[model samples]
Target chain A: MNAAVLLINVMALAGILVAFMDDREKAILSIKIAFKGFMQILPVTLIILIVIALFLGFVSPENLSGFIGQQSGLGGILLIGVAGAIMHIPAILSFPLAASLLEKGISYTAVAALITTLTMIGTVTLPLEIRQLGKKFALLRNGISFVIAIVIALIVGVAMEATLWQ
Target chain B: MAISSQISNQQNLKDWISFGIVLLIAFVFLKIYPSKTGSVIEYFWQYTMEMVLILPAVMLIMGLFSVYVSNNMIEKYLGKYAGIKGMFLSFFLGSLPTGPLYVAFPIASHLLEKGARVSNVIIFLSAWACLKIPQELMEFQFLGWKFMFLRLFFTVILVIIMAKIIEYFFEITDDRL
Candidate 1:
C-alpha cells in the first residue's frame, strides 16, 4: 500500500514538473509513448508475478531455508551462497516470506541474505534480461552480484552478531 | 537524427514477437498452474485501479525523461569520462524509477539506446531494482536497521565493481560482435 502510494505521488510530481516545460505537445506525445511502453509490458509483469507466487505457494522454501540459516560452519556459508545466487522473487513479496521464515526458526542473517538476494540477483530473470540486454551482460552482472550478496551477508551477519549477540 | 523508419519497423516486429512468446508462455503456465487458473477475475479487479494509475504515470514519467533529459546531458555527464559525478548521477537517477520488473526491463533498453553505457545501465537497473533507498527504509521498518543499511552499503560497492567487470567484458565482446 505504501509502495502504491509512493509510486503515485512520484508519478504525479514527475508529470507536473515535465508538463511545465516548453512544448506542451511534445510533452503530451512523449507521455503517450511511455504509456504504450507500459501497456506493452503489463501482461508480462502480472504473469511473472503470478508464476513466481505459484512457485512460492507450492514449491516450499523449507528444505533450503533450513540449509541457508546456519549461523556457523562452512556448510551454512555455502548454503547461504547458493541461496544468494537465485533469489529472484520481487521485493514486495519477501516480507511475508521473511515473516514466515522467522516463525519457522530461520536465522535473521540467512533471511536477510535471502531477502537481499531476492532483489539483488536474478537467475530467474536471466534469460529475459539476456534477451533484452545481451547474454554476456546478464551473466556478468548476476554472477558478480551473487558473489557480492553472499559476502555482504557474511560481513553483515558477523558484525551484527558480534555486537548484538555477544 | 533520421532514425531509419526501417529500424523502428524492425523493432516493432521484434517487440511483437517477444510479446507473443511471453503471452503464450503465460497461457501455458496458467494452464499447468491451476491454483491461479480462475483467479484472473480477482486479480483484474484488484489490480485495475493501480494499473490505470501507474500506466499513465509511467508513460508520462518515462516520456519526460527521454524528451527532457537530453542524451548528451546523460553522456557528457555520465559517460565513461564523467567519473564520480556521472556515477553519482546514475545512482540518483536509477533509484528514482518505479514499477514492477516488466516496466523496468525495456526502459533499460531505451536507456542503452540513449547513450547510456552498459556499465551505467546495468548498475542503474540493478540499483533501481534492489538498492533503492526508500525500499530499504521500508524493509528497515519491517526487519531492522542493521539488515537494511548493511545490504545497501554492500550493494552499492558490489554494483560499482560488477559494473566495471561488465564494462570490461563488453569492451572485449564489442570487438567480436
Candidate 2:
C-alpha cells in the first residue's frame, strides 16, 4: 500500500482505539455510522470507477489533449468548470480522476477549475441549499463560487507553468 | 422524519438505477473493443482497490467526527464569536469533515437565524464545501503538495473576500428593506 493509504489507516486505527477507550458504546456507534456511510458511497464509487476506466481505456491521449490540453485555452477550462459544477461525485474520488486527466495531457487550469467547481458549487444540491438558506444567499454563494473557481483555475495554470519554466 | 426517509429512499433508488446504466455501458464498450477489455478492467480494478484501501479509514474518521462533534456544539461556539475570531472559528468548525455540503446548509441557516455574522456563515459554508481536512489530505496525496497548498491558499483568501462582499451586500439590502 502507498504511504498515504498506510498513514490514513494508522490514524484511523489510533482514533478507534482512543474512542473505544473513552466510551465503548460511542465507539460502536461510530463504527455503525462508518458502515452506513461506506454503503451509501459504494454505488457512486463503483460507477465513477467504471467511467474513469472507460475514459482512460477508450479515449486516446491525443484526442483528450486536443479537447482540454494546455493549448485548449480558456474555452476548455470554462467547459470543464461547468461540468464540475453540475457533477455530484465525491471530492475524494475526484482527485485521482484529476490526476489521470493530468496524465492524459489535460491542462492544469482545466483540472483546477474542475476540482474547485466540483467542491464549491453544487447544482444538484441547489434545491436543498435554497430551502435551508434564503434564495438570495444560495444564489449569490453559488454564483460567486463559479466566478472564483475560474479565476483560481487561471491563477493555478499560470503559477504551475511559471514553476515548470523555473 | 418519515418524509425525509422516503426522500432518501428515492434518492438511493435513483443512484442504483444510474449505477446499473453505467455498468451496462461499460459492458457494451468492452464487448465492442474486445482487445481493450483487459486494460479497462485493469484500470477499474486498480482504482477500486485504491479507493477500498483508504475509504474505510476516511469514513471512520468522518463517523467519529459526526458522533463527537454535535451540531449543537457548532451552533454554540459559532453563534457566540465575532470579528476575526469568529471567522477563524467558522473556518475551523466547517473544516471538521463531518458530512457533505448539503448537510451543512441547515446548520448554516440556523447560525444565521441565531444572529451569527453573515460573513462567518458564508465562510463556514464555503469551508465545509471545499476545505474539509480529509478531502484536502486526499488531494495532497493524489495531486502533490504544491498543487494542494496553492489551491488551499488561494481558496482561503478568495473565500474570505467573497464572504465579506456578500455580507456587505446583505447589510445594505437589509437596511433598504
Best by lDDT: 2
Evaluated at residue B38, the lDDT of candidate 2 is 88
Best by TM-score: 2
Candidate 2: what's its TM-score on chain B? 0.92
Stretches of model 1 off by over 4 angstroms after superposition: A1-66, A71-88, A164-166, B1-81, B113-115, B172-177
Q: State each model's CA lDDT, in order.
A: 0.60, 0.86
State the weakest 10-residue window (summed lDDT) of model 2 chain A. Answer: A157-166
lDDT of 1 by residue, B16-89 (tens): 56657766775787788777655543443444444454445544565566555554454445444446766777
Error of 2 at B169 (Å): 1.1
| Chain B TM-scores of the candidates | 0.53, 0.92
Please write out the lDDT profile of model 1 over residues A40-117, one tens digit for every residue: 544444544444443444445466555555544556765655665565434644644554455455666676667767
Worst 10 residues of 1 chain B by lDDT: B1-10
lDDT of 2 by residue, B100-167 (tens): 68878878888988889888999999999889887886787678777888788899989998998898
Q: What TM-score would chain B of candidate 1 score versus the native chain B? A: 0.53
